[model samples]
Target: MADGQWWRDAVIYQVHPRSFADSNGDGVGDLNGVRSRLPHLRDLGVDAVWLSPFYVSPQADGGYDVADYRAVDPLFGTPADAEALIADAHALGLRVLVDLVPNHSSDRHDWFRRAPAGGPGSPARDRYHFRPGRGARGELPPNDWHSLFGGPAWTRAADPDGSPGDWYLHLFAPEQPDFNWANPEVAEEFRAILRFWPVRGVDGFRVDVAHGLVKAEGLPDHGRSARLLDLTSTPFWDQDGVHEVYRDWRRLLDSYPGERIGVAEAWGRTPVRTANYVRPDELHQAFNFHHLTCSWEPAALRAVVDDSLAAMRAVGAPATWLLSNHDVVRHATRLAPGADRARAATLLMLALPGSAYLYQGEELGLPEVVDLPDASRRDPAFRRTGGRDGHRDGCRVPLPWHGDRPPYGFGPAGGPSRLPQPDDWAELSAAAQDGVPGSTLELYRAALAPRRAHPALGGGDDLVWLPGDDAVLAFERGAGDEVLRCAANAGGHPVEVEVGPAGELLLSSAPVDHDGAHVVLPPDTAIWWIPARAPRAAPASAPAPASTPMAAQTPTRSSTSALGPPPP
Candidate 1:
C-alpha cells in the first residue's frame, strides 16, 4: 500500500486503554502503560493501534462522556503521557488512532455546566438542544425519542429561576448531553477539537457515534418501540446533515501531514447507506457491522462478505473486518461453542480483502467474563434497564497478562481489578500461551506475519466464489500467479474437497490432512492456499520474546463505563 493509503490494507489492533495494561499501580491502564507495550504491537505485526477513549470525563459512560476533549483523564494519565505514547508508537512503525466522541459531551463539560445557569432561551442553551417540555405543567418529555441506554431521551434541566426547567436532549446517558450540531458554535468547537489531537501527533481518530452528530430538523418523535439496535430512520441517528460535518472534518484531516485519517463507527440499515460515510470526500473507513452480526452459517457469512466488499468498492473504500470488540461477548463465546471456531472465524476475516481490526486480548483467546456479579456491573446500559439487557462489562474486564491467579498480573499485586477476572483465565493468559506452538496466540502471530509479508494476503478488493458444498465457503483473492484461495468449513463434520493444481497449502486454522488430489478440512476450520510460486519470507518485524514482562496490575476505582454501543 502507498503512504497515504496504509489503512487500506492495514491490520489495526483495538486497545481498550483501561483494560490493556495498568501503570503506576493504579489498577487502570494509562498512556505510559500503552507506551511500555508498544513493542508488543510492533511484534504482533499490525500496522496500527486504535485506542479507545481516554479523555477527561465524569466516567458515567466510560470516557465517552467527554468533559474536556483536549485533556487526558487522570485515570489514564496526563497530556504529556499521551504525546509520548503516540511518539513511541510511531517509532515502532505503528500508527495511533485515538477515539473521538463527537456525538455528546459530559454534563460536567464547561458549556453544559454554564448552560443550565442561563435561562431556557439563552445562547448558552442554544449550544445544546434545550427546549421547553410539552404539557400544561411541562411534565411530559419533549418527544417520544428514547435514550440508547434506556428511558426518555430528554432530561429536565435546573432552571435559573429554580422553577421546573426545560428539557435537554441526550441520546445516551443523561450525563452525556447531545450536541446541537445545527448550532454554529457546536460545529466550530468540534472542528477545534479535531485539530487539537492531530497537532499533538495522533495519526487519526476513530469517531464514536459518527452517524449521530445531526438530528432530524424538527427533532421529531420516533413514534416506535425504542431499542438500542433499532436504528432505522431514527430522528436522532444517521441524518443527512451528519455528512456535511464529516466533509468539513475530512478537509481539516487532509491538511495535516502523515496521511491522518478518520474511521467511523456508523450503523446504517443497509450496506449502501453505511458506505456513504466513507465517500472519498468524507471519512476514510467505516466498520462493517453487517459482517460482525453475521451468523456462523456459511451462506450468511458469504452474503455479508459479498455485500460489504461490493458496497466499499462502490465508494472506493476498503472493507474493514472485525469479529469481537469491547462491547460484545467475545467471539469465542458468542460465535460458536469454542476456541477453534473463533480461530477459524478470525482466519477467515484476516484472509479476506482489505483491512482487519483485532480487538485486544482476542489473540490470547480470552472469552467474555459472563459471570460478573450484579454489583460489579458498570455499564450505564445495565443500570438504566435494571440489568434486563446490557451486560457489556463482561467483555471489558482487565486482561490477564501473566501469572496464574485472579487479576493475572493485570495490575500491581494486592490491588483488585475494577472488574473481576475469572480464575480459569490462567489457562488463557498471555503468559501461558506465549511461545506455545499451535497456541491461539501463536496462530495469530503466524497469520499476521504472512499478512504483512505476502503480497497476496492483504491487498485487493476482488473475490471469486469457488464451488463448494452448502456448509463450505470458498473464495479466491488476487489474480494470475498472485492468487490466494481460502476455504472455511462451518459444518460439524469433516469435509473432503478437491485441491486444484493451483492450490498450495499456506496456513490453516486447524490441522488439515491432504492426499494427492484432495484436502480434508476439519470441522469449524479455515485454510489459506496460495500459488506454489508465491514468495515466502519471515515477517519484517520479529515477534516479542516470551519473557518480555508487561506491567500487570489491578484496576483502580474509577467511574469510567464501557466506551461504545452494546454489540448487536
Candidate 2:
C-alpha cells in the first residue's frame, strides 16, 4: 500500500498495549510507553508496529468497545501523547498501525447513550440495531443470535418513557452494541474516522470484526446458544454486505497519501471467502487465522500454508502468516515442554514468502501465563462464559522487561500492574536474551537479518515445496546463487532431508549435521540454506590478489546453529 508492496513482506510486531509496558507507573501501557520502546522494535528489525486498541473506552472488552473514535482514553493517555508517539515512531524509521473497531461501539458512546431515550422508531435509535421484541408482550428477544463472546446477542433496552422497550444487537458483550451498517449515518461516520488518523501520520488501521459489520437481512437465528470457536459462517458473521463496506474503505484509503491501508480481521469459513476481503478493490490485507490455529503437524501446516498462498495469490494479495497473538495460547506452551517446536514454527513462518506477524514477548520465548489467578482475569469473554471458554488472559499478562520478580521489570517497582506477571519470566526477559547465543531472541534477530539483507526472502519470491515424508516439509525460493532452500522436521524422530548438494547453511531452528547433499535435521527443526556464493572474478584491467586462493570456490556454509538446541 505504500507506493509499492512494502507491507507484503514486512515483519510487523503486535503490541498488546496493556501488557506491553507501563509508563508513568500506571500499571497499563500507554502511547508514551510504546514510544520509549520504539527502539527495541527498530533494533529487533521489524518494519512496523501494530498497536492494539487504545481509543476511548470503558475497558468492557479491553478497549475494543470504542466510546469515541477521535479521542484517546484518559486511562491510557491523551491525544497529544498519541500524536507524539506517532512522530517518535516515524523518527525511529518504524511505521505505525492503530486498531479500528468498526462493527460496534461502547453502549456509553454518545450515539448509543441517546438511542434508548430516542424511542424505538426515532432517528437517533436507528444508528444502532434497536428493534422491538418478538413476544406478545414484546418480552422475547428479536432473534436467537448468540454473542461471539457468549450469552444471547440481544439485550433488552429501556424506553424513553422508562417502560420496557426494544432489544439491541451486540455480537460481543452487552457493553458493545453493534452498529447498523444499513444506516447511512453509520457508513458516513466511519468515513470520517477513516480520514482522521492517516492525516496525522498514522500509517494504517487493523480493522476489528471486519466481516461482522453487516448481519443477514432479518435477525435470523444462528442455531446455537453460544457460538463455538470455529470460523464457520452464520447469519450474523461474514455476510456478503461486509465486502461492500471494505470496498468503500479501500476507496477512502486510496484517497490519502503515504499508502494508508486497512487490514481486516475477517473470519471467512473458507480460504476463498477470506481472499475476498483482500481483493485489489477491497482492503489491503486480512489476518490468516488459519495459520495461527494450525497444529504442530507437518501435513496440517502444509495444507494451511498452501491454501493461504493460493487463495491470496488468486486475488493478487499477499498472504499473512503468524504463530502467536494476544487472543490465543502462545506457541511456547502450546508446543511445550521445551521451546524447540515453537522456535521451529517461528522460523518456518518467517521462511515462508509473505508478511509475518510477531506477537509481543514471543521473541523472548515467553509461554502463556496459564496459571493466572481468577481474580486477576479481565477478559469479558471469560467472565460471561461462566469460566468454560475464553482463557485469553493467560496470553495477555504484562511482559517481563528485566527485574527478577513479579511485574518483572515491566515498570517501576511497586507499580500497580493491570495484570499479574510471572516471577519466572525474569530468566526469559528480553534483557536476559538480547545477545545470548542460540536464545529465541537471538534466533529472531538472526532470522530477521537475512530477511532484511537477502533478495530471495523479499516480496516477489514464490515457495516451491519439495518432496518429503508426512512428518516433514521442504521448500525453496529464488534461483541460482540467490536460491534459499528450507526444510523442517515436525516429527518425533530425527530426519535426513535432501536439500541439494551445493548450498550453504544460513541458520536453523535447532542444531544439525549436514554434508551439503543431506542435513540430519532433528525433530521440530527447520533450516535456511542458500546456494553458496561464488568468488568474485578479477577485473579485466587488474589481477586478483596473490593471497586469494582457488579453493575459495568451495567455501563452507556460514552458520550459527551448530551450537544451538539439540534433539530433546
The TM-scores, one per candidate, come to 0.93, 0.92
Which candidate leads the pack in lDDT?
Answer: 1
Supply candidate 2's per-residue lDDT for 55.
Answer: 87
**RMSD in Å for all candidates:** 7.0, 6.3
Residue-by-residue lDDT tens digits, candidate 2, 236-338:
7788888888988899988977678788888778779889999999998899988888888888999998899999999998898888888789989987768
lDDT of 1 by residue, 168-241 (tens): 99988999999888989999998998989888888899999898989888889888857656878688778899
Worst lDDT window (10 residues) for model 2? 549-558
Query: Residue 256 lDDT in model 1?
Result: 97
Q: How far is candidate 2 from the true structure (C-alpha RMSD, Å)?
A: 6.3
C-alpha-based local distance difference test score of model 1: 0.82
How many clashes in each structure? 11, 0
Native RMSD of candidate 1 (Å): 7.0
Residue 5, candidate 2: Cα error in Å is: 1.8
